[model samples]
Structures are given as structure tokens and as C-alpha cells.
Target: MDPTIRNAKLQDIEFVLSGIREIFKIENDIFVYSEKKKLARNAIRDKHIRVAMRGDKPIGFSWFKIGDLTPFGLDYGKWSRKYCWISFVYVLKNYRNKGIGSLLYEDIMRICKRKKVKQIMLDVFTVNKKSARFHERIGFKPLLSIFTMRAR
Candidate 1:
């Protein structure tokens, strides 16, 4: 059976943390579980987060935020009135390739449409070609390239 998508709740913290851990592992980034937990709590409370559930188990999730571009000095009226930035979309390894991620995105799309969001944006790591391709397949175009240099 397919997973169902629903808004995340504080009760889902552990599952969300596990998903964040997996993402950090994939990115080779370091994180403290306690700190990540705090961020996850805040995300659940402040941002728009949705989880994919198969029965009672959480299998995947997507995180995003809605805001206006006017804060960034782009006061273009309706064009900049509303937008969405997808921060993360992840599925458990075992549940991947089964359309759970797409289902989560479909939920986000429905929310955006209801809110009249003008644009949706997201950042994919250069090393994660799979995610970049998925975004492209979903009609997301590259708007800018970001580069970073690590110092020793």
C-alpha cells in the first residue's frame, strides 16, 4: 500500500531526527543529536513539515517554509508576495524508489496552490546528483550556483 502524507507533529520528533541523521550522513556533515533535536523541534513548531506514513510508521518527510521576497528587498508585489523554499525531502533507504518522496512533494504542491505561492525553490548539494535530477524532473530549474571553500 502507498504511504499517506500528513502534517508533522511534536510526537514525531524521533522519526524526524532519524531522517535528519540519515541526511547528514549522506552529506558527510557533522551534527550533534541534541542540537539537531532542538532544530527539529523548532521546525515542527514553526515551519511546514509533512511526513509520509505507512500504517503507523513514519517513512519519509519534507520540510519547507513560506515567505515573501520583500524581506530580501525584492518588493515586486504579487510576483514576490509569496514563495516557498524546500529545505529537505528524504525517505528511509528501504522505502525509496516507491513514490513516497513524490507523494510528500505532491502534498507540498497542494499547499502551495492553496496559498497561492508564486515560486518554489530548493538547494541540492552538487554531490547529490540523484536529488538534482529528481528536482529537474519535477520542473525545478537551476537559478544560481553556490560555491564554498573550506579552510584548514
Candidate 2:
């Protein structure tokens, strides 16, 4: 089905948040509602939240922000006045492999371009191979791996 892509409405807050929590649970066996809720609420309220739906059901979503210029986005240093960062892009498991994620990403890209954003950045978990591949395919290059050292 051709997915419907548009800006998320205030009414979509709960539904979008629920969808993100559900998707995150697939990877995180022990999901924390508090953390996810905070992140979801922030993303949903941001003007950049893009929602993709199959009828009334939200199948995918992406959150983005325009700020300082970075390398992983369009026009490196050209629009130093503005930059964009994609915080979250989630698609339901059942909808994986479809073009929905790409669609949402493209929408974010369009927004960035319109805003004259010079670059964009996002961090994908090292373990999420699918997400890594998707970002790479979408023209994002890995710069560094974020790590934490625990003294045990």
C-alpha cells in the first residue's frame, strides 16, 4: 500500500509514542517507559516529527532538528547558518523492508533542504545492523563509534 506521509498532529502524540515504544521493545528486552516516554514526548512535540501511516495506523515515524552544520547531511558547511539532526526513525517490524522508512527520511531531508541546513547527524546503535545499513544506504558515513568504559 502507498503509505500516507505527513506531519504529526497533536492527537497523534499518544499513538506515535506508543508505536515507538513498541518498536524499541523488539530490541530492548527490558524496555523502560519513563525514558521512552520522555524521548517520545519531546520528539512528538518537535516541529520536525514526520509520521507515516497506513490509513489510521501509524507504521513509521522520524524526528529531526535543524541546528549546527555537520558532515553527514546535505551541503557540508555550505549552510553553516543551519544544520539538521535526525533523532529517531522507527518503522514497525511488520512494515520492515518497505520504503516507508526511506520515505520518512526523504521527508526529513526535504525539510532540511528547505531550511538551508548544511548538514545532519544521527547515532544508530552499533548492534542495530538494519538501521546502520539503512543510514549508510541513505548516504550517512560512519565517523566514530560511541563507547563507554566501565571500570569493573
Please report the candidate that would top lDDT against the real structure.
Answer: 1
Question: Roughly what TM-score does model 2 have, to 2 decimal places?
Answer: 0.78
Task: Point to the candidate with the largest TM-score.
Answer: 1
Question: lDDT per residue, candidate 1, 30-55, as tens digits?
Answer: 86899988878888888578889899
Clashes of each: 0, 1
TM-score of each model, in listed order: 0.86, 0.78
Error of 1 at 121 (Å): 0.7
**Local distance difference test values of all predictions, in order:** 0.83, 0.75
lDDT of 2 at 85: 70
- Whole-model lDDT for model 1 versus the true structure? 0.83
